[model samples]
Structures are given as C-alpha cells and as structure tokens.
Target: MNESIKTPSVTDEASTPQMKTKCEHHAECMKVIQAILDDQATEAEKDHFRENIDKCIPCIESYNLEKCIKTSLADKIAKKPCPKNILNTIISKINS
Candidate 1:
C-alpha cells in the first residue's frame, strides 16, 4: 500500500502559478450559497455550485465560513422548556 503523500516544498509552491485570489462571480455565488444552505436551491443551482467550487477558491471560502457560522449557532444555542404555569394560563385563556 502507498504511504503518506508528499507535500510540495515552499519553494516549489512559490515557483508554480499563483492560486487565483479573486472570483468575478463572488456575489452571485453568495446568493446561490444561501439558497443551497437554506434548502431552497433548485437542482440546477446545486449542480452549478458543485461544478464551480473546485476552481473558485473565494466562493469555496465563503461557503465554508457561512456553513461554520450556522453550525456553531445550532450547536451552542440552548433550548428552554416553557414554564408549566405559563402554559396552563395560556390554555385556560383560550378555552374561556
């Protein structure tokens, strides 16, 4: 079996073509990203993002940042149960 993969040295990386730092469609990408994350994206939108994400680093980073924020909020926020007294009062008022 093959062992560990070899990472390029700093010098080797420096000599290669620079990775793209900007994406022209970043704004549009963000909108599509929101739709996708919110489960509102059409199948075509999902396919488009999947096709472009590998080449567009800016969009990829934005997607990751948005995902992290959503995940953190979901995991950290506490859910509290309503007090029984309040629940009883609301039910009594509705019945009357």
Candidate 2:
C-alpha cells in the first residue's frame, strides 16, 4: 500500500474564511511578523505591523501570542545554563 499526504496550495490556503476574516493584509502581515521574529524587519515593516495591529484585531492577537511565546522561551533560556560537563560532551562528540 502507498500513502501520500496532500498539501494545500497557496491559493487554497489564502481563500479560507478564517484567512479572509483575519486581515486583507494577511500576506504583508505575515512578512512583517517573520521579519520581526528574524530581527530583519526594516522600520517601514515595523511601522506597517504596528499599523495593522491597531486596525486588525486578529493580527494583534496573533502578534501578541507570538511575541509572548518568543519572550517566554528567551527568558527561560536566559535563566537556564547548560552544565559544563554536558556542553563539553556535546562538543567532543561533534569534534569526533
């Protein structure tokens, strides 16, 4: 037996009701979100994101959730140090 998974096309994904209701600027919003996460967004992109967040409830909620998750993860990592022994072991394994 053979099985395959089906992936939705960009057009199909963009046409969903949820996507439509979320924001007409969905593509731009996503680009801004990704750029912000990657720390590569320009001032214009940041401004665009800020503007959309004010006008789009869904965009604001999504942005807030992502920002919360990212901040939580960074805070947790910053507070936790890897043990020296574990770090050395991993380094040695990689060197081998």
Question: What CA root-mean-square deviation does each model show from the true structure?
Answer: 7.0, 15.0
In order, candidate lDDTs are 0.88, 0.78
- Give each model's clash number: 0, 0
Write down the TM-score for model 2.
0.54
TM-score of every candidate: 0.63, 0.54
Root-mean-square deviation of Cα positions for candidate 1 versus the true structure, in angstroms:
7.0
Give the candidate number with the greatest lDDT: 1
Which residue pairs in candidate 2 have backbone atoms (N, alpha carbon, C) closer than 3 angstroms, thus clashing?
none
Residue-level lDDT of model 1, residues 1-96, one tens digit each, is 556877799998878866457988888999999998888999999999998887778988999999999889989999899999999999999999
Q: On residues 1-96, what C-alpha lDDT tens digit does candidate 2 reach at each position? A: 335866789998777634224587777787788789879999999987766666677777777887888888888875668899999999999999
| 81: Cα error in model 2, Å | 1.6
TM-score of 1: 0.63
Model 2 segments more than 4 A misplaced: 1-21, 37-40, 71-78
